[model samples]
Target: MERSRIAVAGASGLIGGALVRALTADGHEVVRLVRGAARAADEVRWDPERGSVDADGLAGCGAVVNLAGAGVGDRRWTPAYKARLRASRVRGTAALAEAVAALPEEVRPRVLLNGSAIGYYGETGGRTVDESAPPGEGFLPGLCVEWEAAAAPAREAGVRTVFARTGLVVARGGGAWGRLFPLFRAGLGGRLGDGRQYWSFIALHDEVAALRHLLDTEGLSGPFNLTAPYPATNREITETMARVLHRPALFAVPAPVLRTVLGEMAGDVLGSARVVPARLLESGFRFAFPRIEEAVRAAL
Candidate 1:
């Protein structure tokens, strides 16, 4: 498919920054929606909290991707922080959806790839789940439901809306894996909790590629799991990291310790969601690093 102009919200984030670089390197024009003033040709000011966006800036774009949201693991799960998490995702998505919906048909983007997460499935334990599975219980699941629902305006306006239900992004720089790299390098890395909870992870390289696939593909709409085919247990992941980094995986953080240290967020950290990219695979998307070892090496 030929590259087209795409507008991206949260373009400063890990995935968004990588996506922008990938798109631009491939000759696609990208316009970023920024919270600050538009100081560059590629930037457009937007405030999701106030529900304001420069619609004129969005005009003529072929696609819009809204990845605006608070980093789930960036802080402790205090009531206020949890509220910010919900507000950031739900409000930002709603604002973007409304902006796209208000656009004239001639200039409206064809597709809207809104940000979502596999947390919708809650704690799937050892059981595997695809997009077909219904939502599970808890705060994360409920928050995900609201996050996806906030994009209804775009879908209702006949935009080809898709939810990129992302999994644990295994990257070197910033994410859950970011904290792991230093520890493992110092030979202090170990499994969290019982280390048996399943973790569905994807390489940063494949995550960007999958997003592009969703953006460019035709006749594709709805939720797609952006995860690898194989789901590894936390213990397996620790072993892989140790083997790859030549470190010993001798230590383990018990579940009680995790709860004490991470507070409410510990539940999510230890929760299992054995997710698979069923819809993405069915859509003919291919992953560059599908295995745990490959993904871990790629991150390094």
Candidate 2:
């Protein structure tokens, strides 16, 4: 592949950090679209809150990956925090899209992989859905709808944009799965609620690879599910973790208790989304770890 400059927002997060490393490792020029003043030649300043980006810095880029968003499960879903979540994603994405749109047609990137989530499908209740399914009800799904729409500017500009609907990324260092490993290791880990909700998960490495795959694959555009082919239930995932770590996943967090503890965020924790990577598979993208067991082992 020919080397090209790629601008990436949110370069400090788990997926973003890994993607930056992977792109640079392959000799691709990576420009970091960071929040705040530019600290280095490779770092370009952009403030999503202000809807400002270094358009000149991103001029003539080959591709742009916008992974800017707040952690959904990081805090309680107080009205203010929920607002923060929407703003961080919707505003940040619109800012990036506008910046890319400002570029000359010839200089515009070939693709824009705007980050999204499987929450677009809302609570599936063990029902499987793919990218083709319509957006569901609830705050998360509603937020995801707006989140993906924020990239309309870039899409309208004819940049082959992709809504990268990512699922629970199983990594040892960060994300919900990162938080899970330690608890399971301590033998304090257990399934949430009824342990019946479906979890569409991807290994960290596979998640990065899939994003890179989308970057290179030009024929693909629009929403694509970046999850394992075989999604497992919460109970199945819990059992796998226990077996993989040789620890007893002996406890169960009750639904009402979780609701009381997590507040509005409990709905998502207990929601079921049996997602499938139909688009990714049909596009000929292969998964390095398609099974939950494989993903668990990788996370371990």
Candidate 3:
């Protein structure tokens, strides 16, 4: 692969951090867009909330990956929290898109990979969905809709745009897996709700690889479902984790309890989405860990 100059927003987050490391390892010049003062040689200050960024930092960059956004699962879904969630993604993405659009044609990055989520599909029960599937209804889908729309400026500016509709990313260091480790180790891990709802997931390594692939593969565009080919149910994931850690998976969290504890946010944890990486697979992308058991074992 040819060495390229890549500017990445939200370089401090989980996926962003991994992407930075991956890009650096691949011999690319990485410019990190920070919110405050420049912390290092490659760091550039950018305030998305104010739509301010260093144009000089983005000059001559071959690609820009916007991973900036508020954490959806970080708190309960209060009305104010929901507004913040929507604004965080929309405003931040629009800021990057506007910055990229404002750049000179010759210096502007040729591609922009914006982040999205599989929650766009809402609760699909056990039915399998792909990139071609229509956006589902509800808060998550609405948020994703606006989030992707915020990147329209880049697309209109002739930059190839790719919206990564990510699924549950499982990693040992952080994310969902880390949060559930204690419960699983204590033998209190179990399925959420009825355990029949499908849960789409991807290994962190695969997630990183897919992003790299999107950056390299010029023909790819639009919404790409970033998930393993095989999407398992909640029960399956709990069972796999239990088996992998040598624990019991008998204790299941009832839906009512989850709703009471998590409020509207509980639907996210209990909902089912059997998402498939149709576009990715059709494009010849191979998954490192396609099965739930293998992914959980490796992650553990």
Tens-place lDDT per residue, model 2, 1-300, is: 368999999899999999999999999999999887999988889887667888888888899999988899999989999988999899888988988988998888888899999999998886789988999998999999999999999999998999899999999989989899999999999999999999999999899999998999778899999999999999999999999999999999999999999998899889899999999999998999999999989877
Q: Report the alpha-carbon TM-score of model 3 versus the true structure.
A: 0.97
Worst 10-residue lDDT window, candidate 2? 47-56
Model 3 misplaced stretches (Cα beyond 4 Å): none
Q: Which pairs of residues clash in candidate 3, taking residues 3 or more apart in a chain or in different chains?
A: none
Point out where model 1 deviates above 4 Å.
Answer: none
- lDDT for model 1 comes to 0.92
C-alpha-based local distance difference test score of model 3: 0.89
The CA lDDT of each predicted structure is: 0.92, 0.92, 0.89
State the local distance difference test value for candidate 2. 0.92
lDDT of 3 by residue, 76-193 (tens): 8899999888877888889888889989998998999999999899989878999989999999999999999999999999999999999988887766777887889998899999
Every candidate's CA RMSD:
0.9, 0.9, 1.2
| Residue 11 in model 2: lDDT | 92
> For model 2, which pairs clash?
none
Ranking by lDDT: 1, 2, 3
Report the lDDT tens digits of candidate 1 across residue range 97-209: 99899999999999999999999999998898999999999999999999999999999999999999999999988888989989998999999988999999999999999
